[model samples]
Target: MTQDTLNILHLGLGSFHRAHQAMYLNRLIEAGETGWQLAGGNLRPDMADTIAALERQHGEYTLETVTPAGERSYERIRSIRRIVPWDAELAGLIALGAEPSTRILSFTVTEAGYYLDERNELDLRYADLASDLAGTSRSTIYGALAVILAERRRRNAGPVTLLSCDNLRANGERFRHGFLAFLRQRGESELLHWVEANTTSPCSMVDRITPRPTPDVAERVKAATGWDDGAAVMGERFTQWVIEDRFCNGRPAWEEVGAEMVASVHPYEEAKIRILNASHSCIAWAGTLVGYRYIHEGALDPEIRRMAHDYVTDDVIPCLTPSPLDLSAYRDTVLDRFSNPHIRDTNQRVAADGFAKIPGFIAPTIRERLADGHGANSVALLPALFFAFLERWHRGELPFEYQDQGMDPDLAHGFFHAADPLLAFCQDLTLWGPLAGDRQLAHAIFGAYARVQHFLGRSPA
Candidate 1:
């Protein structure tokens, strides 16, 4: 594929995008596919270093994959045709989206990056969301897309699909909902009509354990490739992308390159989100409190792994049972993958966006279990661990920084100061969702909190 043949505009050019989606596209290109070269951009400056490094390398990078047996391999990825640098204005990204050839706008802007409420509305409380309300292109996916899609509408660019590659349940539909809500907030009925008419949002489920790059990654890349790669990414050997076979413009024959193009991504999505993703965070938060730096260490610990295993086998599996996938095997595979020593997946990385992770990944099992009149004890343990981790942060005992897009420091501090922090944390509607006000749910969390405290050999707070 030539650079001029770019047909995919990817937003949020970060680690996961580089390792997962871009790698899939590169595989297709290697097999003689055409007309889908990727153009990457970031709305926020958080990855300025990555953007600059990719630009310096002319959009080529290395991918290091480590297997469960500690086997490491490297691949040179050249799927990205160009990267729109982070400037004060988002004009370049808007123009890329407006190009008629750019039939797809895919993104890996994390779960929290969506900035949506429980109602799936655009969250304007964010500064960029507020600024974008005034019609200026800036940061945040909503603001950025509001500007880009408006330009596409004005230019009458051919219909394009907004493929969301985040760890979001109903990701494509969620993005579509947030986009329409943002447009409505902008009060652009004509543009809104254009977007509604021209866009397709197909839900998908993406899985990979691509942790943040460590120094050893660069060293391995240099030794293996005879050159240094600053923007290298390291991921697990196993990867999957189950996309709903619905598209507006057109989609690559991704299935030809190991992606699953299915009629409904619902079953696959539910299993992955509730099982793999939720258990990942459970280990991460629990691992952090136990002074473990990496997820594998926690996965190795008997207490930690038991919490995750029970959470999956006891709670998540029953809720998603009698399905096509083998829930037991999937549960075991996820735990085994989490225990991969070579990956060195950091607790901080997995535990960063707990506020978003809870609603998207953990809470569904709880909600389903509660709705069925079954106790959600196993699932309740996750948030209990997170709240305990938050307490450590509150007391400055946490060795690493805790970054949460939706966390309110004042509200979080109140948890530590409350007469019963576990009950207070359990009652936070934003985290526990529909079960926030349920006393039974609070009671379950209290029991989970006691388990976590017992694991840590600490007195109950």
Candidate 2:
């Protein structure tokens, strides 16, 4: 561990970061790069145990990549230099952010972290933001970043680039909104202005299927290395990151390490949100309804596989900007990636956090289809299935576990129950934005919801 290595701090230590960003940094290191090393902070107390285990192993872990060729495991991933528990070490977390060596602040805190209002500005109503404004020790990654940026401004230090690896569209913009809202609320107008003028939050599109490793995979890694490591991550062989060329401080030669740096990440982000994410939600909701447990099993089923493919190719892809890449090739790759048996991604895991995922991933596409004067025949079917799934999931009738992150269960129930004709649910502008006001589109979606519900029918509990 050399001091000269560039210090990059990652906020969330989830499976996605381990498989995606950490692996990318490792690739750079293996290629003889010296300017990049990673440090991590786990935001929650329960995460401290995992952080401790990774530190005990010298911040080293194995990555098992599953592809059609075979399952290959890489044993030595040395890019991660340290893991700091955020709750136990708040001062250390703030200090790491103020360090001049730290140029990039990356996060995978998921959509919930943004905490936006109806206008999509940072939600001041959030309890954590309220606490941060009161000059309390900020706990969430966004809150911590706000405090760090305020400190960095006082020191006249150089600006830092913030990167959001979450699934939300224009995720960088959302993060900026949340961070700026916190700064402004704290009466730090000058600091807020400085960040607006100096910092860059580049939009990006990232795709990879990294399932939380099964106990068996963890055991295998330990048996292979004669070391007990619990933080190992297993993922599908496929991975892609397309980022807009925007940064305040200098960035890693990520392009040199197979990341695509583009003039605008909009097209790539839109494509992924529509084609990949939308299809994933469809499979997740519908597969669970049909009693399939794993993503690979759902992909294997003749009916479910066709529905997933058609939902993407026939409906979603057409709504996206035309790309030079072969659409069929992309679709084939997505299917193959989902079918990787070595990754046991549960339908339930994919279905988690529907409130955040749907509006960004599926509903936006639905709006696009409607705006283009396309009927809801195919596109509307997805949310219909989703709404149905929500109804069942809330009632505790579905076998899959639902993770709501404090979103009101009654509100979810109301959204499904009140949309009696099913298409009426599309009329809830609060849920679908302004597009929900379009009567023709709303009616079409309602019809589709009705059709799916009719098909499912009332079975014995």
Candidate 3:
């Protein structure tokens, strides 16, 4: 064990980070590896209680894992050595990020947080991105990182790896594009040059069913481990992290701890996004419409499960043929993971980002199938389900609040008020991109929407 410790300044300190990436680092440490540590914080001021609790424990927390048969286990995760407290000015986060020892800067800001348009450019329509570009705010990931990188450059912190663990396809490349655009728009030409020469953003695909922590997580931890751990997190027993090996400075030997370090993460990411993520959302939206509270309930429901299975088998598998993975087996495993009753992943959590998911996770399959003159009937059902889910949200019929960061409330509400709500939804450029008003796309969606209506025991719109 060396005295010099390398640091990863993780941007988001949420449950996913605790259960997935930090857990991998903890595994390395547990296996007697040293000189690699994680310092975690968040750009947003949310998760106040969790942050405070972690601070009290000096960044230690418990992680509870459960299997399908309801077997549970707990481990004390001590990888996060520092919990930088939240501040309006982000002074603490910047300080840590600029440190010479912080060799890697990683983030899980969620899919919508990127704010990239269909053209893969940073969309200024988002006020947060605009504010960050105009130097008024640092709430967005690009903004927060801009100041941190500027400070790092000032102190000559040398090179660092900017790893994005988000669900975006080519996440590292997309983030680099947006980050460079943010710098360009902010007129930081010198800093942009420095960044181009000094940083590496490797695309990574992270999979784990880390649900939002409930009170029961802490209770279970106390019962099993005899600890009153307020900051404990829980996830399913399955976990995977696949990263492209393109670090500029240095990185942990993650591959030694069950993390897949690959030459290209494209195939892995595409499969996960189209198969697991899109299907997860499909189950969530369909389950919510049919009054299922948890993801496992929907995954176990024959009808909803078939909807996901058929989508992958019909639309996605064709697009992803000649790939490294066994698509059929992957699909079944994903469904089985979703069906783990012990995880208790919520409908609201998975179903929150319909607007974003449509474009990011589900649209490519529809676009590809249509281009090849193949039927997108199965994949179309996902958007149809989201449309029904959105209508419920519009009518205040949802069992819980629908949280969509990428949603424009005015535009979404206007859909229900339009003369033909379904057609209005079909023409959404943000959702469908170039295929927004395509007749074939609309026809498939309309047909699928009717099936959705029939499934819900309502007359077709």
Candidate 4:
């Protein structure tokens, strides 16, 4: 293979990429496809340990899978050609993107990583945005992306595709919108024009239940393969990637590896978001309130599992009708995956980002239910559980450190201190998105909140 084969540069080198995208790319290579190699790195220093471990292993790692019926399997993934070192100034990242051979830059940065505000525009008020505006490199996704685009423009790098693999709806469009606004904020009209003409952002829907790796994964790998792997990651056997058929440059033979390249990813996107992502968060929050540590535990619990099923059946499925996949089967499959006891999916991991999740995962469904004048009982349960969880965080009662990029501790603390805590919670415009001002939403939330309270009264949390 020629040097040009190593062309895809991926951001956010987390476990999900190893088990999902990189794995798909590896499959293409195995199928005799050439001229495509995965180069990856984290934008921030937070995951330096994993990167360092990858360096020791020469960018190869083990992926362990636990089936629904307790079968375990392992495989070595060798698709990532290099780990681009983390640099505070993002010079290395910019260099990677500026290379002529780099045709597609993909990312798995979390939902909150993109500094898009309520209107899905670049949020100028975000502290990192201010820092990036002040010329600090790599402060946020916008910052790193700005530098990369500018360098690519200067180098006259041909058209490139920025593929978003995040869970947010219409993620690619949102990235382009926020990125153009960011360039406008920087007053780089030339770069902005270059970006518009030279780049394409394709929305994608990616799925796999990859939990944070605990010691058990490594132990299992060692016992099975007799190789001590420091960078091993694990996931459920199920994986899917549905991509919108939009790319400025060519792409890997991903379809050969089970990825669906289609006319539009909207139906798949909406189904996964409303059903899998939303109900996952529901089980996470509800499980936390009831002292469950793992997702399967909650999925097995009668009340917690019932809440998730009702949330999907009563409102989410209806909200996402007329889709490509059978909604009912998809819902059942999601529960089956969640109930995979071997996965050990933690409530804390799923519940950590409540502040970032409400708008995309929960609020949209609630807004639709209220707008249609339908009973929002199942949908409203999400925010009600969030309110309870936040109160626990405020009281220092949570078992783990709740990590929310968008929530402020002082402001969160003030929620319970306020005379009308429910009103205080509902008034945060950023949290609920467009539905923040809808009095109907606030009323529905309160009604649901009362039910959660009354249920807790009997359940003994």
CA lDDT scores, all candidates in order: 0.86, 0.76, 0.93, 0.87
State residue 57's C-alpha deviation in candidate 3, in Å: 0.6
Please provide, for model 2 over 1-461, each residue's C-alpha lDDT reduced to its tens digit, 9 standing for 90 to 100.
Answer: 35565678888888899889888888988898868899987666656666877988778888877775666665467788888766643666677877777888888887767776446766565566677668665766666787777777777767889889888788888788778877777788898898998689988888889877788777877777766677787888788998888978887888888899998888778777777787787777777877778888877766667777887876777876477566667777888777777788999888887667667777776677777877657767787787888778767898856885525566666765562535545665445766666777677777777767765664521
Question: Which residue segments of model 4 deviate by more than 4 Å?
Answer: 459-461
TM-score of each: 0.96, 0.92, 0.98, 0.97
User: Against the true structure, what is every candidate's RMSD?
Assistant: 2.0, 2.5, 1.9, 1.4
List ranges where model 1 is wrong by over 4 Å: 1-6, 458-461
**Candidate 3: how large is its RMSD?**
1.9
Task: Return the lDDT, model 3, position 176.
Answer: 96
**What does candidate 1's lDDT look like per residue over 6-50, in tens digits?**
488898887888999999999999999976889888887777777
> Candidate 2: which pairs clash?
6-35, 423-446
Give a tens-digit lDDT track for model 4, residues 1-461.
Answer: 24546499898899898999999988889889967898888888877678898999989999998899999989888888788898888778898888889999999888987877677876665677788877765667777888898899898888899999898889999988988888888898998999899999999999999999999899999999998999999999999999988988888879988999998999999999989998898889888888889999888888878888899999988888877799999999998899999999999889976777898888888888888888787788889999998988988999889998767677788889999998888987778777775788788889989988876776554
Higher-scoring candidate on TM-score, 2 or 4:
4
The top-ranked prediction according to lDDT is 3
